[model samples]
Target: MTFTLGPRAISAGYQLAAFDQIGSTNAEALARARDGERGPKWFVTTEQTAGRGRRQRAWVMPRGNLASSILEVMDVSPAVAATLGFAAGLSLESALQKLAVEANMRRAEPLKFALKWPNDVLAERQKLTGILLEAEAVAGNRLAVVVGIGTNVVAAPEGTPTPATSLAALGVHVGAEELFKGLAEAWVEFRGIWDNGRGFAGIRKAWLDRAFGVGEPVAIRTGTATIEGTFDTIDETGCLIVRTAEGKRMPITAGEVYFGTAASLGAT
Candidate 1:
């Protein structure tokens, strides 16, 4: 299937570049940004040979999966630009909801699809999508950020760190192109809501509403130390707020979060 940006995405100043195969969409996008390609563009590929998730973890990108990256040059600082991960996560959640509704496969319970802390989208507590955000400094204090997203549409990798599932595994027969269409359109809407990180309060609220393990026990691993606490709310800067057993609220800026006794860990 040919990948194309929807009218909504184009109207919102998004350009599309589709590839049959690539080493890494995020890498290509960043390379282009460094060469003075200041674009709000989408770098999409059917297959990625060298894709990576957060913390340099290997990202399995099968041929039928969705491997795409959004590159935007922003005036915001790198710290502020990092918040776009929340926007991307919320966008993916919205896109999945739309796909489920279109297939008439809505879950009876509310959280059939939910967002994990930092950057994962889960379907029934199993990971369905992963998000990665990378940023580079440009001339004159401008920063360029690339939001990379990968979704398991037809198949999920086996023996992953966390339990994995796909749309096909869930009995929803959707193609990567179809999913990307929804994702592109939904991204435009969510970007508008984000307003370049100025409107983060609404994004934070929406993300928490669909959060997978809020108010539940979670274990967060940051390097050598592991901290177990109750999953609390996210702060204004999009940090995960974990309330430890000692009644202290610790805001985690980066870590691997595991929920509900899941020993497996994934990057956040």
Candidate 2:
């Protein structure tokens, strides 16, 4: 299918490149950015042969899954640019909500979907979508970030670290192309809310309202060490705030978080 940008996206100077098969959308975006391509462009593919997730985990991309990446040029530090993951996550959640409503899956109860910390969207406590952020150094000390998003529309892999679900499993009959249209539109809205990371306070509040496993027991794995604590709110800097049983609050910047009996190194 041909991927076309919506009117809102086109007005915002967003471009889209769709492929039937590719090594990795994020890799292509980063390569283009390094080669002097400044863009708020999107790279989408049906099959990703060499897709990789956070921490270099292999991402299984079947034919029907949504494998897309957003490349944007930003004049911010890497630390601040990392917050774009929140914006991307929020956009995906909004897009899925629209699809779910259109499919009449959950018209009255829209809270069935929730956002996981750092960059994941959970539907009924199972992973429904994943996001990966990659940044590169550009000229003039600027940075380019590629926000890669994968959603399970028709099928999900089995035996994953965490349980997985798809929109089809939830009775939502939508395709990748249709979903990308909604996603691209939502991206524009959420990016405006983010205001180049300056309006993160509102973004943080919105994310918390839809957060999954907040105030619940959680285990976080940072490298080789594991910390068990209650899931507190995310800090202002986008760190996971965990309150341990020993009355200590730990802010986790990077790690794998597990809720309930989900797998330890779950996909994010």
Candidate 3:
């Protein structure tokens, strides 16, 4: 159950639990967090059989891939939980950057990837990873939050709603045991940025750095009526800012973004 981290993570004292299979890491992590079993001091799971992402979507993960969840209790307002996924997105983006370099993935000219608002990682516009945050009301005074992440280290199943890619496809052969610890460590750095009333200015800055569609015309579906707008930027709370087709600046809390491109379609 215990997986060893590479030398890079050892100095940081990251411990990971590896699983051959599981229904969902986020679900398991949430249950554990509710039991007082999470925080910056602990990291869980190296791989999951059935991972999960936002809105209960499937987080398809293959063996030897990055599939784990970080459990933490936050002071965030549940009303804004939809936006908090951006923090996790920022963290994973940094981790992937490190992975890409360590594996010498850049030599292959892999398509540059970026974070899609809400919760997905893209490679050349196709999804390479996704984040899932689950929370539950706890007794007395605490809420349980689990940040589950899934990345394609080897491959994702075909016939998924959108296209997918793996590290291997980009010339990076990242093994599960070798990658989880670094991912855990990256969360620690990001959690620090999230805490301390800093809001998401830093996360937004980094997100915007690798973000796609900042100046492109796009549409976000709110279900009742679609909002067509031009992509603007991210705000302090990590919410996406868009200029409505009417030229009004709008902060979108929730929706599926459509950018008329393959890499932007993202998740199901």
Predicted structure 1: lDDT: 0.88
* TM-score, model 1 to reference: 0.95
Worst 10 residues of 1 by lDDT: 102-111
Tens digit of lDDT per residue, candidate 2, span 123-143? Answer: 988888889999989998889
Candidate 1 Cα deviation (angstroms), residue 187? 0.8
lDDT (Cα) of model 3: 0.68
Error in Å for residue 32 of model 3: 1.7
**CA lDDT, every prediction?**
0.88, 0.88, 0.68
lDDT of 1 at 185: 96
RMSD (CA, Å), each prediction: 2.1, 2.1, 3.3
Off by over 4 Å in 1: 105-111, 263-268
Clashes of each: 0, 0, 1
Looking at model 2, report the run of 10 residues with the lowest lDDT sum.
259-268
- Model 2: what TM-score? 0.94
Model 2, residue 119: what's the lDDT? Answer: 88
Instruction: Quickly count the clashes in candidate 2.
Output: 0
